[model samples]
Target: MTTPQDAIAARRKLTNRLIAGKDARRLAPFLASDVKVIAGDGSLILGAADVLAAFAGQFADPDFVAYVRTTTGVELDAEGARAAERGTWVGTWRTAGPQSGAYLAVWRKVTGQWLIESELFVTLG
Candidate 1:
């Protein structure tokens, strides 16, 4: 059985994954099939594949620099099957300048794995 602590840890790993600015492959295990993402640009993206494609493009750019996420708070349900993670994300692109934002991710336990079901992020100037 997945404990609440394990769920929290999983969420941490997901943040670390983003911070590393690694390949989108690292996201597969943490994202649900129908996951919804509201990016800082205010664009709406749906599904794991679309999300992956978006990142692939982002990561492909050489100017796409560091990506980091810092979780300030996380709340898990009694059953530990659902959670909300709120944090800030800061990124740098070679020429686009810095993009920083606050994010809230709603996670769901799917197939015994805590996967991000929906995420919304807003850019901060």
Candidate 2:
């Protein structure tokens, strides 16, 4: 039997894996079949496959680098089996230059596994 604290910690670890996974390949599993991603620019992306396809070229670029700097203000709702995590990420692409952003990710435990349900982010200096 896992304690609530233990479960929360495990989830946090998984979240980190999702953020810094190998070339974003690890994200393929958690994404729902019909996952919808809304970009910071207000563009609606439909389906996980579509999103992956869109990013395929970018991920292949050797000069495209990304990193998540810090994660904080994590709130877990054990009762609801949902969690909200906040973090900052810095990305540098040789062509596009550099960008830093803060993000809020909402995750839910579905079928005993945590999956990111939605994410919203804003670019920062």
Candidate 3:
């Protein structure tokens, strides 16, 4: 039986895979229908298309390297079958700029697949 905890862990793993996937440039394949991304600057990016446009250049940059150290404080909504992963991502980037931030990602299961529904990023020093 698939418990809520298992589902949450699966979602988190999928999230990591999506970020470090071979084709990271295109995120639509790994995102949910209502995916929304909130940048550190408080910009609300709606949909996969908007996210692609906003991150297209950065994702393709030669100096872009994102390393997710650890993910903790994960919470699951069993009834809604949603999960949230909170963690810190530490890494260095040359094209866009250095990136060291805390992130919160909400995921949902659709068609038996877990996908990121919303994400929020906050820069940390």
Candidate of highest lDDT: 1
Off by over 4 Å in 2: 1-24
What is the clash count of model 3? 0
Candidate rank order under lDDT: 1, 3, 2
Question: Residue by residue across 1-125, what tens digits does model 2's lDDT show?
Answer: 97544564566566455554535666566655666666556677677777666455556777765545356666888586887767776766667867877877666777887666766667775
**Tens-digit lDDT string for candidate 1 (41-120):** 89999999999888888888888876776777788888878988888888888788788989998889877767889999
lDDT of 3 by residue, 1-125 (tens): 88655666665666456555525455576677678988877889898877767666555767866545356767878576677878876655665666678989887878776677888988785
Model 2 residue 84 lDDT score: 74
lDDT of 3 at 91: 56
**Cα lDDT computed for each candidate against the true fold:** 0.81, 0.64, 0.70
TM-score for every candidate vs. truth? 0.85, 0.70, 0.74
Which stretches in model 1 have alpha-carbon errors above 4 Å? 1-6, 18-21
How high is the lDDT of residue 1 in model 1? 73
